[model samples]
Target: MFLSRCPLSHTRSGTAGSEAPATGETSLGDSLGTFRRQQDILTPAELAGMSVDIVGAGALGGAILLCLCKMGFGITNTLTVTDFDRCEAHNLPTQWFRPSDVLMDQAKVDALAEMVGWVCDRPITTACDRFRGDESRRLGPVVILAVDSLRERQLIWNNLRNREDVQLLVDARMGAEVLEIHCLDPRPSRRGTTRPAGPGTREFYEESLARPDEAFQEPCTHRGILYTTLGAAALVGSILRAHAREEDYPRHLVFDFRNFILLAHGEGHGETQF
Candidate 1:
């Protein structure tokens, strides 16, 4: 019998079949073979050579990373994650870390990377420090900005707005039951360009970034909810799926889990139940 080598299995090492099977024995298929189920929706070819940078490993960031891992995104894609905080007891309720992770006092990115290793073969480049726009030379073409503060978002956007290397940016914000996601293209506008994002997009994003002190402050207990974070992650996955297909997606969206309402803005403006 002839065994077919799976292309998506190349990155995964030391799985069940690294050794040659004994004579007359059948080999267990590679770990990524399960991806066959979603072949029609997203193939490994669509994600080949893709690189993504996730700038936070808090509630929404951790949830999104797990969702992507389960979707076989790491098969042929590079992922980099940055976060400076350490796991704590409070994080357990909303974030992805286990109780043991908090006991060990692991950094958020480090703990998240370890969890990703268990879920998939994707190697995550972790930075246990804050992301400073001035210090960064270039980020991945696709960036997920999941930082908590409005000021941090402003700083990141200022650094990325004029960058030619960055094409897509997804910003996720959540407060207990309400979630907001913004998708932007940071490239400068050119005449006759048909890109979905341009000067108008930048202006709209800037308007949403009010002073941090002025923004509504939810009590610590009401800041994050697991279901809301998961909902945000699912919406992010939808945006990425559309991007992988080279299709258009909403530029901004808001989902109120408590009310079961979803409002999409820019290009595809509508209200519906989520």
Candidate 2:
């Protein structure tokens, strides 16, 4: 649903939309009118200087990219996407891709880069390699982890935890009907969590790893839904946007889509593992 709203880039000849409306193109001045009003929370200047690197280009990452592009984030900030995965037939339902995309056999990051280039007309750097834990591997100042496996996520956190350049880290995860978004900004002396501030990531990873039922496919499998993916990505984008503006929201956020309950980290907020 949210993907429908992203104004994407298009090649003049092979573009998706052939017709340019009689109203003509909307100028950045007209499209960016909302930013001027939200100057208190997030101004264009603040978002301009930050560089964002998203680890995975799946459902969550795709939505986040589209949202950021629509908001004109890449106008000044550098947005780098890294994903080695390709779009398959199964991804058509949950991810933002057309039938033609599956046949192209293109990398997820490349496809997104093309789309975003058309939308914002901004250059998007893409990497077709996995994000292995490397201390010297620097994509940008901010990192967003949307990878599938637990080990991969932990590896990234451990590598960039103490790095001086890393300003923010956001991990977006989802279960059958719940989505959790965790943010971490490390300072040498000041700390928030007991350890590196995983926000239930360690517990969730261990439980999923030990679950015997996960070995065999059951009738009811834990898969991400299109609606849930959009919801989750919106929350991730919102949290990152708040982080850029230095606004106060939540260090950890868990939302229950089934019950329509939203909880933020605090005294009563439970750190539930997926």
Candidate 3:
């Protein structure tokens, strides 16, 4: 039997089985380097013309911002981030931040946005203010509600609900070792008269910002765990990719890292182990 020809034989450099490229010519690998170095499975055009707006820069929000950046979100899409918080020593444990950024007179969004721009070669806009009220505005069509409290989430959601400009919403909530991710399109339910339209003559849903203590904010130590956020950020990245592909994504996902359990909602809810 005759030996087969080597695949590398076709590579340029005017020599058989050579990987090097000739001067003035780019190699195939060089051409696809950008594509292959991507941290996401989604295509480069994945957010395309649409921009992203993230409302928080804490554990969950910070993780999501960095995750999307790694996935080439910064390169392909304009990213608008908003937060009224600052980076402190305690935040270094759970959020994507550096120690030197602690006292730079920079807001959380300003610091991270700068880092992301430098690292990703894409400049992202920053708003060092809180999002509030009905009839408010959004920086982009897609919004990520990564705020700390339920009341904050409700406020932003209710405000964004009426905006024809706001089309997609990704809500992320983390509790100890578990996190809930919900992707909402905010489309009016088409099944009218299918049953008596449930409560609220008109409804724009948001989570209850209720916490056990008299204090609403999470204790500094209880912000989040490193492990839980890694998994949650990866999952939310998947959600963004699914949106890019126009695939049917989970309306709600609750992942419990404590027991390795996963709860996903379809038309209804179901649970399973990862």
Candidate 4:
């Protein structure tokens, strides 16, 4: 028995052999592959633009704005910041403000945008008022609530939750030694509803600017420049990643700078130790 010769030897036999391109059309297959390859190389315009509105211009917000602007994302993806407070003398070192910026009405939006324009050639927009009332409703979809008080955080959610456009809500707080970053991604079914508090926590839908012994203007802790910016910048980078993907992360990242360890807390309900 000759054993039917080698199957690979006959290119045109047995229904055009399995080695040939599907349907005997290498050109079509090559074209389809090339199309997919080209699709993967999408431009900035093709990607969903990022419009980040940061509330507060203290250590966290200032650092986050500086880092994001320096990254040179784009002009169209505007950064609109809101802060009714000005930079204080003590915040000079850790915060991004300089001596010249003192008493000069360093509105968070204007000052940060000016810096972005000078350095990144990207101009950030401004809304010098507080991130509440009818004016704040203009800024939707992405909100970085970096305020100092729980009251302010609650107020931010009240405004953001009612809106349909806002998808990502990031709340980052840094004490003297610990830093916590909370992220709430919109749900598919109730994407427009107000954000419900995490499993055991109370719903802070009406965050006012009042909490005696811990006033909105009161500074909770004296964080060094290293940890403040380090933690806030990291959180901003994480939010940007989530924004770029338009998805939710698996856990909340808590950075304990004093211990030099990063802890990720699971969703649903759980505690994590660094």
Q: Which candidate is the best by lDDT?
A: 1
User: What is the RMSD, in Å, between candidate 4 and the native fold over all Cα?
Assistant: 20.3
The full ranking of all candidates by TM-score, starting with the best, is 1, 3, 2, 4
* Evaluation by TM-score, superior candidate among 1 and 2: 1
* TM-score, cand. 4 vs. native: 0.67
Per-model TM against the reference: 0.82, 0.73, 0.74, 0.67
lDDT of each: 0.70, 0.63, 0.62, 0.55
Residue 202 alpha-carbon offset, candidate 1, angstroms: 0.8
Model 4 lDDT tens row, 27-97: 32223443344344322232245667777777788788777654433333556667766656877767765
Residue 13 in candidate 1, Cα distance off native in Å: 10
Ranking by lDDT: 1, 2, 3, 4
Top-TM-score candidate index: 1
lDDT of 2 by residue, 1-274 (tens): 2222223222211134343212223335535574666666555466766878888888888888777766656555667777778878888777766778789775676667666656555456666777764635554677788887566766666566556666666778766677767666543333544343244333332343354334323233556778888888778777767667666556678788888888776223344333
**Model 4, runs deviating above 4 Å:** 1-47, 103-105, 133-137, 186-221, 246-248, 266-274
Report the lDDT tens digits of candidate 1 across residue range 132-239: 654445677788889988988888778777777777888888877888888877677532343333222766677778567776479976887788888888889888
Per-model clash counts, in order, read 0, 3, 1, 2
Q: Is candidate 3 or candidate 4 better by TM-score?
A: 3
**By how many angstroms RMSD does model 1 differ from the true structure?**
9.1
3 or 4, greater by lDDT: 3
| Tens digits of per-residue lDDT for model 3, 10-55 | 2112222334222223233324565575545575565676678887
Candidate 3 regions with alpha-carbon error over 4 angstroms:
1-32, 37-40, 133-138, 187-220, 267-274
